[model samples]
Target: MGLIITFLAAAFLIAGVVRGSFVNKRANEELPFPTPVSQEVEGSTDDRDVPYYDDDKEEDEVIETITPFIPTPTVSDSQTSDSSATNAYIYPNSTVLSTTANSIELSSTSDPGDITNWYKKLFEEKHFKARSFAQTNTNGHVLNKLAGAGGSLDLEVEIEKKPNEKITVIKVTY
Candidate 1:
């Protein structure tokens, strides 16, 4: 009687495990999956919700279509003209990144003295009010007073030579 009861219990446990796994297979197969809507689809929630983008547009056309990352450079209140730019000599490798109505910022690989020589002429030849002398072996600035329509335009050129840097940062600002 004990052997019969044990055998019946094992058979019932095996049958329950098999029935649970197989029961869901037919139900899952009968139901269809919810497909995702494509971006290219027209007149649905997917089409109206997505932002517009065209792949076939030309290079220039696409550039024109998109907004600029940076705002366009505007002339500041203390702006100077390009007259000083033409007068001053620049190194061949120097890059003039920006030029405003009143100021110019550039970087050069040439000697700082060479740049100072050009600014010196603005005082001597053109009669711009300039500093008497520059200190030796330091970041020296040549300040010149340029008489503007408003008043005296403070033109200061900083000759900064950093250690281990090949390029000298020269900023001529008024």
Candidate 2:
């Protein structure tokens, strides 16, 4: 009786295991398979039917066909002509050694007795002839009567003359 009971219990356990495995297999096989949509089908269904464009478009499509990257040549200051017709004059003995946008450099062979005389000649030559000399120092001289009589009389001077060789470097600003 004991042997029969044990055999019956073992058979019942095997039957339950077999039934559970069969049901699991059937459920796996009957599962609804997901359908894969092709690229063409997905694109056609989209609201924007046009194909997606990457950065790999043709040269013509990627760049503007009409206008290309054209480099423009630059014009230099030497090539441009002076627009103003007004002319300036330098004394026959005097020559403009160099010039800049802000100042004019002049050299002369005349004897500048003192800073006062040197400043006077410089002022007169620069169209400040109507003005009078004001003061003088070891460095430079000043003009008392302004060129624009009532306005400002701003001047700066630098001398680079050797005793034997007569030359002067006068810098003026107004």
Candidate 3:
């Protein structure tokens, strides 16, 4: 048993020496590196120290001033109501989809009932009478206000929330 162990150890040491010799030979070889190629310009001379520039003549000096631009601010609901002739009021935080002379469509992330309630309060504050209809996913209101010279202005508002949706659609007609 001792003789067999001695032979196995000698065989392993010889195999390691052979493998290390091959690795060392590979490591000593030089690696190839890339070199850059110089490009010559069409009008340049043989001198390499001076640079080439096309513009040789000096021109007159010109100074220009730059001004910062400012954008116009958007009108809020309260500010818009006082200036509009129809006294139309849009819900805050709602995105307007379309608008015409007599109608407006809007989209909101609020519930249908909340939008309906807001319109009801707005009508009451304007001293107008409104009739409301409500269902599980929809609400509607018809509002009336006295116009000048014995004429009446009618406004219709509808709010709908589709099933399993977080968005509500609003349609207002005047």
Candidate 4:
């Protein structure tokens, strides 16, 4: 039994030494050798022989042929005239409350209902208050009305004209 064990140990040691020597010799080659070409490269033809950019000029010509069209915004006098007419109707009896491209200010002796009634009569759509109306007594009149009771009574309404150039309706709650 002792002899068999000793023989097996000697065999393993010899195998290990052989493997280590083989690896070391392979890793320590002295030649500064060039890398071997892969099989794909060895069998390939010259790339320049075929036209790689054959479609490049054609592609540029195609792009040039496509002229980009940018449409300009045309403001018709009729539209402006219509907008002014609508504006005039919105604050017929009221004082020049405030006026801007996007907003209007009016001071009137009438109640909030009167203001709403005017809007309802002029525009097909309903206009509601965006925020509480702030109450101010400018010459004995409520300046702006918020949408509902206890909301601001003084109103600064934001009016937006839709892309179709039609007026968008807003309601004030006060």
Candidate 5:
């Protein structure tokens, strides 16, 4: 048994040495000539990939911000009754942030499980056709279509929660 163990140890050492050369990556080599001029350099205009650019030829940029088709329910004079209750956000102490590109970010103190169920019920009640709703751990993906903007909008609602924290964040990408 001692002889067999000694032989096995010797075989493993040789195998490891042989594997090292095969798995090791090549070392970085210095360039034979200077680096290409197109590469980014400090205080160089080469970053734009053009030798020269005329300020007079620049075009004006116009950005059109999109608005969400579905607005959150609010108490109004016309909706003073039961309809206001349906439009109001159900999660207490939650904030929804609206971005310039029609994206919505929501943060709440509720758990991911509760948020998922609330959204599922909300979308279903609003007659939004759900294409996919998947949940794993604290991550969720919800794809639904509103009454409008189905032709051009690639809308997505994503939910993520960090471990060892009570905050769950949701993002709506439109």
Candidate 6:
């Protein structure tokens, strides 16, 4: 009886291994799992709820369609029609990015320290009180004066030079 019981146990273990192998083989031959399918709901008129795909779309074209921001150069300081239009003098070698009624943005390749010193002297000569500050990557100045319109006007100039970059951004606000 002990021998018969031991043989039956061995036969059962062998049968389990064979069955498991068969199941694994079938799993590999077929899809391991069912894929999710999108279903449309009845009476849904909103097209946004549906998914649309264009098979011809290429990712390369999407990258090519992007436009870069290019700075637009303004008239040179000497070529400015009216000095009053811009109360503060623009850097001679700077490229103007944009201009508004009370502010101007520019890009330059000059050293930040040189630009700050130039502005300080220019403002002082014009009889405006100026204060300047400097740091590792940036320098700026603030000029104050009694406005002809009976109020005080302050001009702020900031220059930033990022590490490993050739372009310096300058912003002037009045």
TM-score of each: 0.39, 0.31, 0.42, 0.27, 0.37, 0.42
| Cα lDDT over the full model 1 | 0.59
Ranking by TM-score: 6, 3, 1, 5, 2, 4
Residue range 21-120, candidate 5, lDDT tens digits: 6656323323233223332356875566533334444335543579879987787774343433422433455686544334567788776777767666
Poorest 10 consecutive residues by lDDT, candidate 5: 141-150
Clashes of 3: 0
Q: Residue 87 CA error for candidate 6 (Å)?
A: 7.0
- Please provide, for model 6 over 1-174, each residue's C-alpha lDDT reduced to its tens digit, 9 standing for 90 to 100: 999999999999999999999999967763323334445657877644454454444333232255889999888865554646474568777998998767788888987777877767665766665454544532333222211111254667777776677888888776
Which of the predicted structures, 5 or 6, would earn the higher lDDT when compared with the native?
6
Ranking by lDDT: 6, 3, 1, 5, 2, 4
Candidate 2: where is the Cα deviation over 4 Å?
1-62, 65-89, 113-162
Q: Would you list the clashing residue pairs of candidate 6?
A: none
Question: What is the Cα-based TM-score of model 1?
Answer: 0.39
* Reference-based TM-score, model 4: 0.27
Candidate 6, superposed: residue stretches over 4 Å from native: 1-88, 130-134, 138-151
lDDT against the true structure, per candidate, is 0.59, 0.49, 0.64, 0.46, 0.56, 0.65
lDDT of 3 by residue, 91-146 (tens): 77588898877777888997666777787776666666545554452234222221
lDDT of 4 by residue, 54-166 (tens): 32222212222567999999997644535654354455556564455545544554455556555544333333334243444444333333332213222334322223332
Q: In model 2, what are the clashing residue pairs, if there are any?
A: none
* Candidate 4 runs further than 4 Å off: 1-83, 125-174
lDDT of 2 by residue, 1-174 (tens): 999999999999999999999999967864333343323445355655444444333343232257778999987865543424111323345677766554456666654445435455656655542464433333443222222221233344443454444564443333
Q: Give candidate 3's whole-model lDDT.
A: 0.64
- Top lDDT model: 6
Q: Which residue segments of model 5 deviate by more than 4 Å?
A: 1-92, 138-155
